[model samples]
Target: MAESTPGFELPLLLFAGFRSIVDQLHAELARQGHPDVRPAHGFAMQAIGRDGATASELGRRLGVSKQAAGKTADRLAALGYAVRVDDPADARRKVIRLTPHGYDVLARSAAVFEELRTAWAERLGEERLRQLEADLRTMAPPSGFRLDVAGWFGA
Candidate 1:
């Protein structure tokens, strides 16, 4: 038998695991009447919950360009999941915040995530999940990581 390369196997397995979890989450979301929700939207929701961010700040944090972040914000706004108000500090920039609906969606999603996480912990044992997290963190790039949509589905 040959040794696998240092970088390939871990990420492959990590993504496979994420796919399983996300599929389960989507099913749960659909049952809860949020069929239109997406992974990117969930990430944006969390970012809004954490802090009021400018689109450029979101772009920097998400490792995307400002234009890409603005597009995401626009979509979220169209869905009534976020609001953009003129930045007090900078007239040219807009501050992004969660609307009431956005917060409600995020709260529901968090509950679902917690339920799933607890079930997984019970099934796999908390120690095992912790170990897996540590191993994956060790393998990740220092700067951070991004899921490229173009490569994600072989598109």
Candidate 2:
């Protein structure tokens, strides 16, 4: 008889898989000339979006404190990944937006993610990979996409 897997092993294995993918992605990103990008920055950039967002807005979207969001913005600016410009609608506010370099990183990240998925499919067999993804979708909540994962993890 086959032994049952422990419940604790499930989350651990899932996280390990995620960590492996993220680690590989970052390594590739560094090789592609974005050595300074961090996992948090991806969430931040998604929150910033194409239109941009004020610190408070970004903080809300990221589920972090305004101060935390401001710090992130500062770091992104220092890395030339983002910029803060005066808000046209609200003269009193500054909106954070991704720089061209930042957009390039996002685009490159997308391409790398596709490559990683293709690699996984090749290794696991396309059918098995598809089944795995289907199983995940069935198990996971239907929350669409969440940008607050960084804050949730931090909390």
Winning model by TM-score: 2
Give lDDT tens digits, candidate 1, residues 5-119: 7887876877788888877887888788777778888776665555678987777666567787788889889988888998888899889888887887777877887888888
Can you tell me which runs of candidate 2 are displaced by over 4 Å?
none
> Alpha-carbon error at 154 in model 1, in Å?
12
lDDT agreement of model 1 with the native: 0.77
Task: Give candidates' CA RMSD values in order.
Answer: 3.8, 1.0
Q: Of the candidates shown, which would achieve the greatest lDDT relative to the real structure?
A: 2
| Candidate 1 Cα deviation (angstroms), residue 84 | 1.2
lDDT agreement with native, every candidate: 0.77, 0.93
For each candidate in turn, the TM-score is 0.76, 0.96
- In model 1, the runs with Cα more than 4 Å from the true position are 1-7, 137-155
Q: Positional deviation of 132 in candidate 2, in angstroms? A: 1.0
CA shift of 137, model 2, Å: 1.4
